[model samples]
Target: MHLSDHDLRQFDDAYLQTLTSAQARALLGKALADLKAARERLGQNPSNSSRPPSTRLPWEGVGGQETPAGEPEVPAVSGDVAAVADTPGAAAEPEETADPRPRRQGSRRPLSGAPPGRRPGTPGHSRTQHLPVDAEQSHRPTCCAGCGQALTDAHASRAHNARYEIELIQPGVGATGLLLHQTKHTYYECACDCGHWTQAQPGRAQAEVEWTVALTEWHLAGPLLVAFICALSQRMRLSRARVREFLSDWLGLELSTATINQCLHEAGRAVAPVVEAELYAAVRNVELRYADETSWKEHGRLRWLWVFTCATATLFVVGKRSVEVVRQVLGETFNGWLMSDGFWAYRDLDQRLRCLAHLIRKAQALEDGLEPAAQRFGIEILTVIATVMAAVYDARGAPPPAGALRARHAPMLNALLNECLRQRDAPHEKTRALARELLNDWDTFWVVLDHPELPLTNNEAERALRHWVIARRIGMGTRTAQGTRAFAHLASVIETCRKRAVSPWPYLAEVVRQRRQGLQAPPLPSPAS
Candidate 1:
């Protein structure tokens, strides 16, 4: 039935007029087939295929992405948008610097548009623990400034500055029955023999990129406390107010929501540099990576959260869902096999494995419809695919070489391709689309046959996003740029640890401690043997 270019050119009206009745019927059939194809192309819509909803016309009915086979179609759940911003209980909005001016209460307050962070100098909570200082340490200059001379404790003139740090007592430290301990650090100015006064100061660390919440050692909360807050908010998916309530009710710590919120941001900012530089570097070296994206909201506006995962590490990014994001993650020349659904962004990658489950779902939709031809096509394709998949499964530990597999499965594969070619202009729009999709990325569809080690679906990446998708539904989304960064970096660390069979809490606490001391946080802990 194949026609060459010259044969196709002979179908003009001038040549058709001279045909006899039998020839004329053959020509008429071809003309009707072309008309049907043109009409089917014009009928494309989002519900029937991978086309975006925006492409749907005004007359079309509303629908979302086609749900996969055997999985119930979960409608978008709407609820009150929980605020996870730097400002506790505030709605999602742009990050704003906290105003130092005093804000009045109740009726005197403005109706709307209060800037983010703590609202204009409202009184904040103070520490409830009044424990006595367990130890005190003094810092003083040991050398003269003007002259090269050694100094002793007698050279200390006076204690100029002092601060207290409340740290959690380690589990096996003492039998004092105290959960916390305090340390008083006193800084003194020592007078040298040359009459030069050198002052010792407490060390301070700041974020390389400024955020709404500042990262410094002056805060009342210790590194472990900050890490605990992150575990509650980021890992446990608790809102700011919920975290405050948990601490107050359970730990007898009367922490303001503002402080809890700041701790979350500070922890995120602390580990962000290490997460971005080291963790992402690890992701780039994996051989088989899976990726998926889901909707996210930033400041009440639409955004996307992308996840890239492998066996040992996972990375999450909150940004635009574009090809550039894929390139940014996998680099311009990624040689590893990618397992993903048929997103346009992933199409350009030379080595990819299309998720067969997605194709099977589309074929199932065709089978469930009223068209006889479509249903038959669907049943045939599904049987063909299932047989190949089962064969792959049976070969579990010992996969046949590509040549052997091709020899065994070539007849079935050829038959499926022939059917797809015949049904390319199917009367059912979905049938036509399914056929065309298979034909376009035919190699990706059968890549698993050639490389048995590659996955058959993108379930790993999708599973990684499942928990956060619920968080997105519960908390709406992050409110500011800092919140977005915190959510992504912290989630990456948490999931990566879970994948590697390690606990992230202790490592995260250590990261906060080192970063606050103006030192680089340590690399993410590796999986235990």
Candidate 2:
């Protein structure tokens, strides 16, 4: 029954008009009330006897059947309908409900069939067959035994069964022994010249070397010496005896502190080249470098372990704290910027970037509890310095526009320098005077602003060197200059790998393996070989 376009339009209009604003609104309100009642009932008795009212509209009356008017008639239900319906305060049923939890599936059923015997295509089944011998069948020979004639069944029943047993012992401090048993039976043939014998070897035994390689590799990797032993004895505040006891109980290996030290030294030597190569590559690539030196004891004498680092790498050099040592580590011809605090040794380095953060700390201490005059002066100068440094950082990776930067910051810079000079010449306290002397290097300090990428603080380098400081406190510093160098090399590589998100152990292992196999000399920078 396809309706004409005109008829379809008229039908839609009539249907829409039937649901007039007020009538439609009333229907909705009644639906909401019904939904609320249903929800209250469900809440009171979740396992209710009432068949839930259908959300679907009822079918229009067909033929002569009269249609129920206004609301749809609900069907009767059995059991606890009244219990569910008694709750009036329950909330309305939601138009849409989502299950809050996931449902679990039932366990799988077992496969059902006859227990299978060896069949042609079945797994672990073979077609080849062997027949078993029975004592009664074997005794049924019908000849005489002396002349190799068949013997009577009654004479063949005299053969006796044989059995053997052996004991296996596990040798250790707490030894245990296991008994192994074997049984065999042999039949004597009527003919004396021929008899069949069968014997089974002991169950397959494991080769002694099965675990040897893995154990050797584990020890060679220095897990005990480097990680457990050294970390416990040196870093964890454990006594030497306690450390030894832990090794014996946990690893079944006993060692003195001196032996642990020797293993560490050997491991460091084995991995030194890989570390050195990484440090050299990192230093060569970074454009800005931070360097600092801290006191270290070597062979009972005072020395220094100088650390240098950038975004990509960390390198350490051990020597006496002299300007010459710094100059040597950082080649004279090298032209990149070096960040450090106001150490006079670094003063001669043409491209030094003084740490303004250190100066700020000193100024902050001086202005504490002071009059506005000093405080104001200190604040203004620090603010100007910070602003200029920020501008430099903002312009990093590119040259700042000619007069656009310095011209904008010039007035603030002049004002701060003039105030600093005035404070320096004034009759002030000793601390303030010393601060003034430090600030007098404003020309060199503020030069950092001209280079956008160079940081105003040497914090990066100091942070890179922090681990050494902690290690020195823990282990009382390296014992010799060579030991110091080894520490620097290994630490440099390990930290560099960490920064690059590479695992150091695998890299070190490969490098050591290649060196040991004599497949390469100096495992550092071989591109092809």
Model 2 steric clash pairs:
141-151, 142-150, 143-149, 143-150, 143-151, 144-149
Clashes of each: 0, 6
Q: What is the C-alpha lDDT of each candidate?
A: 0.79, 0.55
TM-scores, all models, native as reference: 0.74, 0.51
Q: How would you encode candidate 2's per-residue C-alpha lDDT over 54-115 as one tens digit per residue? A: 21224433221224687665554433565556657434544646654443445233334445
The parts of candidate 1 lying over 4 Å away from their true place are: 1-137, 141-151, 173-178, 210-212
8-86 per-residue lDDT for model 1 (tens digits): 8777888877899998888677666566555444444554454544455443457433455776654333233322333
State the TM-score for model 1: 0.74
The TM-score of candidate 2 is 0.51
Model 1, residue pairs in steric clash: none
